[model samples]
Target: MSTPWTPTEFEQRLRAAGNERYHHRHPFNVRMHDGLLSPEELRVWIANRFYYQRNIPAKDALIVAKLDTRELRRAWIRRIHDHDGHDGDEGGIERWLRLGEAAGLERSALESGEGVLAGVRLAVDGYVNFVRLATPLEAVASSLTEVFAPDLMERRTAAFEEHYGWIDREGLRYFQVRPPQGRRDSREALDLVRRWATTRADQDRVLAALDFKFDVLWSLLDVVEHACAQK
Candidate 1:
């Protein structure tokens, strides 16, 4: 049986999960950052990624439903607002639509999720379903992927500015805003898991949740690449 890990060891293992499996290592994302994708390929990826972006708040809502404490709910609800926006404020979803336009995709089609691949849709839905069925701890733990996200977001924004110069600068706002936001969010999630997942089994479950999210992101990229290949 696996022995309970020290708090520091457990945290290291969690970070290792992202180091090994985060989608920044996915071939499509590597190509994106390398500036190798055609405009069509970029559009394909953006259209599909918009699905994942919009679903974040949905999955977050599922997590919110599982939380009983007003404190937990109050804190968790910010993720939803971060994506969906408060009144008079635009959010990540709108920022993503701007990216779609920058990529030369029709705003209406991107907003409606038209041209999103079959596999991409399934992958995003699986994430929402996973959170719905998971324990509150597991649901929150899955979001620990944010611990690894800021680097990718930063790299992507820089790549856009340097390599894909044709895209409107305004569309880069989503990527620009994400790094600091991701860092803040990841600290909250990592703290939650570090405090709550004290037992071996609980820590294992948290690790599994992070791994599951990694696969979801990888699957989305795989489908995006495949869809682009067929065109």
Candidate 2:
């Protein structure tokens, strides 16, 4: 049998996976952050990204269903609520809608998916289905993308403030709130993967799951670039 990796090494592999495949490296994102995209490109991106954002809770619910402990379920449940919102709090989805408006899209248009590319929807749906069908360990491991997400969020937020300043700052709340939340969520996910992925096979599975997540994220940007090309 191949020797199992030490926890630190296992995690290094995971981080490497993100470094190689994370959507932050996608060409479209690079262009946006570099302030090269036109207003129409930004608008299309905002609306299409909502398709991914809204599906997050549904995927999280599937993950929660696979948890063996009420403690685990309770902790994971926060993710769903964070996106869908709770009493007196407008959740990430609502903030995303506001971002749509700020980017010049109508709420009705975003909700209706009128501006979302079919490929973006397909990529987002594959992510949800992957989580739904995966073992809980694999599912949680896929979310380690969050480990890389905070940096991207900060860069994206800065890009918006500096380059896309026409967007209402208030609509940027989702990015503002995500850095800490992504840290917390990724910490939890990494700990869980460490505990559960004991064998070399298990670690490899986790790595593969994270790669799948990255592919999903990266493909969304691919379609965005393609869509803008046709416009």
Who wins the TM-score comparison?
2
Off by over 4 Å in 1: none
Q: What overall lDDT goes with each candidate model?
A: 0.90, 0.92
Best by lDDT: 2
- Whole-model lDDT, candidate 2? 0.92
Tell me how many clashing residue pairs each candidate has.
0, 0
lDDT of 2 by residue, 63-97 (tens): 99999999999999999999999998789999999
For candidate 2, list the clashing residue pairs, or say none: none
Across residues 7-59, which tens digit of lDDT does each residue of candidate 1 receive?
99998988887898999899999999999988888888888889999999999
Instruction: Please give the lDDT score at residue 28 for candidate 2.
Output: 94
Q: Model 2: which ten-residue window has the lowest total lDDT?
A: 16-25
